[model samples]
Target chain A: MKKINLVLFFLAALVAFVVNAQPPRPAPTPNDTLNSTKVLKDGRVMFSIYAPKASQVTLSGDFLKEYKPIQLVKNDIGVWSYTSDAVTPDVYSYDFVVDGVKTLDPKNVLLKEGENGYSNYFEVSGPESAYASIQNVPHGNLQKVWFFSKVTGKMTRFHVYTPPGYEKMKGKLPVLYLQHGGGDNDASWSTVGRANFIMDNLYAARKAVPMIVVMPMGHPGAGFFMNPGIDEDPYYKQMFDEIMPLVAEKFRALTDRYHTAYAGLSMGGLQAMNMALFSPQRFGYVLPLSTGYFPPQIKLLEEKYADALRNPEINKLKLFWICMGGQKDIAYQNGLNCNALFDKFGIKYEKANYDAGHTFITWRHNLEEFAPKLFK
Target chain B: MKKINLVLFFLAALVAFVVNAQPPRPAPTPNDTLNSTKVLKDGRVMFSIYAPKASQVTLSGDFLKEYKPIQLVKNDIGVWSYTSDAVTPDVYSYDFVVDGVKTLDPKNVLLKEGENGYSNYFEVSGPESAYASIQNVPHGNLQKVWFFSKVTGKMTRFHVYTPPGYEKMKGKLPVLYLQHGGGDNDASWSTVGRANFIMDNLYAARKAVPMIVVMPMGHPGAGFFMNPGIDEDPYYKQMFDEIMPLVAEKFRALTDRYHTAYAGLSMGGLQAMNMALFSPQRFGYVLPLSTGYFPPQIKLLEEKYADALRNPEINKLKLFWICMGGQKDIAYQNGLNCNALFDKFGIKYEKANYDAGHTFITWRHNLEEFAPKLFK
Candidate 1:
């Protein structure tokens, strides 16, 4: 009876792999995960597997497809081989769907721990990739920004890019407290703006002066669990009372107005004016790119900087740069109006108009040009 | 029957829009389609309907579940209105879900253009914006690279930028051939890479030398339907023979070999070498950022430039600049190998090691630096 059962099991195994009178597939061994990275002659990705009995084997993930992958040809050495062309610029999930069950490639190196079994992930290259900027120049480290706001309680984010030689220097670097527009947090400049890349290139080229950049989230309570009241609350007051102290404590930062700067785009641009005029003590360089002073804020501007608008110390700033998009209407005639007001008050400010609409391209370039001129 | 229907709707509307009433909704209006432009004022959006006798009317879209929306109140003008705090940027499809039946907003400018009906879009001041450099720079123009490639046997895409006063010149401007990386067409640099913006900024700041930049499709047969042969296709040959002549003919360009420049990254960088060295008479300046000479092409290189690799003309043709990524192993080492060879051969060249992985940020910055140096 035992012999008969063994024969029956052998026949079943034969039926599983011997579909077209071909030799039976070899049984998979525990260490079949041995064959690893292989680069094809044409730079294609090649890898080996030991799925001896997988009738339908495919590499499905971010780079490849799911479940049913292209068959990997089995070579004489009992290993299955597959090669793939490179794909897009992000991490993708893939699994070796053997017959029916899903499984990750046992050979890949980069993996993020997750709940429902560890899924396989691969990194595809970016054509004009932001992540690749680290190799071209010395990138500023990204340290987390935490601050307690009186208006929204605790927990805020600011990303700082300190100039090179910052850690060892005795004298503090000048600070540029930059803010992002709406919808974006502290991450916008790094991701889409490629701010680090721009700064790295500028600093390397010696065309721009090096300065510390502080990018803070415009919205407060952004990561709040139950209720994120960031957009609803006006945290301009919080900027003065809360964020400044937190940043100063963390980095080798300049303290007084002479060495401090304020800048932002769109909503953040509106905030730049707010920082310079409202606090009046924290910043020396003021730049509002793409958006300008609001109609309601016109009255307050006179009251806040009545004596200093013309003096290089007041709103004139070290570099009171105001700019707007030629196509954008939100800050449309707003720039013209701001320039007119500055003219009226003898504010002695500088303003430029760009031809395109309001976008990260313009804002970053504005800084790429403006930063070198500041604190010079 | 119509009178009875109107009476029923009005009766339902009173209960629906009492302001803070239970089960609040807006009444249905005569028109269809949401006019977001008008409602976008007050930095807020409002729900409205004209249901004369409805108890309640509501607004709902993909953002909501089961069509539960904030209610509306009946104004003196008979329009039911409910003011909402500004929503973020995205497309939304809302329906009245009136008395149980679903209906869309009639007054929005954003249309349901897709096959799916009832789609409305709005841009509520997001940080992601258009390029401002294109509009601000006076000497630059964003023109399309239109060419019928004899190799690809199809019309390919490219972008051409000429510095200010480019057209006024009696003599032709110096030409620089620039290429984008894989998976990206000519448009990638102009749009995502913001190449035009970078150039615009450089020109605006007067930091870059003004010249004409010609960007071509990086891949073979990208716009065409058929593959134009791989290694020995007559198509690539014709690109040098036919297409180059056509582009030179259409644009007022410097035609001599020393007057032309070539630059690209990765696959593009490889192509730059293929064009300049393989078809030696076509170009002068060669800049391959983060790319090595075609590895396997050493065989072809031996056959073609074997004797001349040691010659001065190989270097003296103009400029030969190469860049490499620090973290990149396969490609980085390959580029270094070629740089070493260039040194051994006494070729005049410049090599910079960028602290980047394979990325767009590296190439974009490289271009920002290189474009200004070309034709100087």
Candidate 2:
């Protein structure tokens, strides 16, 4: 018995030695470092990049504001990292310039198409970010719908945001026809503006009524809205004829003008104004955020229907809200000129202003304020 | 009169000279060279990266095959450009190694998240790439749907692809519960696999029936399906209970098992196998592409359902399809082992093998072959 026990003990010791000596599970590669854009508990962000051979890497972003690009310090493991100063609570675009080559954050998956190229974006959460942040509230569902457009003679796509329990809801819900800015498509509102999250948070707080928001592609063809003929605009004709009918049939949406609202930003805002002016009885509320009537548009509106602005039918509108960023915005003067024209025509309208330039931040705040006052 | 004519001529010349000498439009900046990953007409790709200060730049991609990284020549404008050999028609992921740091193509908006990191992707169109290529056929719509999952206790998202005219279709449509690989989410099928294009092409050619493809988030909680107990898997329970019911109610999906098919790749394939075994009558067709049973998984299945393999329910499955790449694939042996086990149990299954290794190319071919055989 002693001899057998001795042999077993030696065998077990050899097996244990082999298991323990099996080369430290291979050291982690440089990519193993999960040091990417991490939001700190204090609301500051920590950005990191693993570039072992890079001589220099600097971080630049709109969140830096007027400040210069922040330089990162390299650690012994060749991962450069930088903890930002407490940033304001909002979504911000950022990029890294590695040895004069401007590139996006490798670790950040969320990207937005900017004037230049695609930039990585992150949301810094705080009290002010509640509207855009993912809260404990019940969330809505977004559907990407593709429909054939007779006006454009091509298949077009749009995004629809249905509120929580929309499927099982008892009756038809009111609709908000939202549109995106100049260079953006229908996806911009939800992806960049966080429109769904904002609506969910507001509905959870009882600050906004439950409604379906439809974001259609504003620029169907080339050349923005510079296409000379108003009737020939593909998106405009499609919205009324094809899009609205499809939305009503496919979704449980209220078709009455009293249950309808229209809002947009920049070029989309211009389109919204045109849509409302062309069909005044289609929408009860018209909101043009961060955009207003230019000289040519105002002249055309005056030429077409000067009495509509002064008549009781216009007064029958639930709300005519206009909002823009601060005076620094390029469109601020246009907003003021349009307001003056409304004043001259004795048209009652509500106005709101924010202290920021023309950006998604301004548009999001505008939506938060504008949505609450709609369909009352 | 001669003197006045001379003066006018001089004025005209001066104005023309001023217009011509407009400072050469200030030299193009690095960002102005929007020339990264351009596909030439002859099926070759031209890759350019703006790394003015970098010492070295090279293009690396699967398209290069066994060749070394293609060295890029820098032009006087500080942009590095390289024209690759005529590549075979397929979508390829690539990255630029600038000064030894691997980075994605900054100008390419299309990206795919691999096991390593995010990589830029470009399509090479040709006859062989028909299933993945965008043809003139009527396209389907992709919807991103979010629903609450009681198993995970979180709002999980999935992507649904509805074929052309699905909205106006008269009857319930068959559903394919497609799942992505380990590192990918619900969007992988549409974005990376080009599943929508594949279905559109197949349907246009009358090679496949019209159906809805639903891709759910397979990895519900933490880890990559390695959380020990298989019965306690969050995604497995969610798919049968919450996901199926929600999809059935929201979309026009046929709830019968005869119309239902299950398919996935790699880790997803493992999960599909688990689901089919757990509820043998739930899916009429089972497709495990580029993945199959390993020793441990086979042992677990044997312990749980040794008699199920010999039973008639699994044998009644409409199709038991197994596909993998050539011998070069790491999972080829796994496929063989699983096949041998099936043979021993007298189970019938269809097998397909391609010449390529483990990649999206192999998976795409497998899907093209497998989809036509489903819901027959």
lDDT of 2 by residue, A168-286 (tens): 68888999999887756687788777899899889998999899999988877655572212475677778888889988977789999999999988777777666555666788998
Give each prediction's root-mean-square deviation over alpha carbons.
24.8, 9.6
Binned by DockQ into CAPRI classes (incorrect, acceptable, medium, high), candidate 2 is incorrect
lDDT of 2 by residue, B19-62 (tens): 47433122347756567878898878889988777778887665
Candidate 1 C-alpha lDDT tens digits along A1-376 = 1111122233333334334455444354533346444544564666665544444545543344221246667665545668878533433444454333333344443332221123334444444333323334444433434334557755444666665444345767778877776534565565445565566666767766767887777766442111111223456656666667766655567778878888887667767665554455567788887766545455555665465554544553667788775654345655676778778876666877654445444565676677777777
lDDT of predicted model 1: 0.54
Fraction of native contacts (fnat) of each candidate? 0.00, 0.25
Kindly give the number of clashing pairs for every candidate: 47, 0
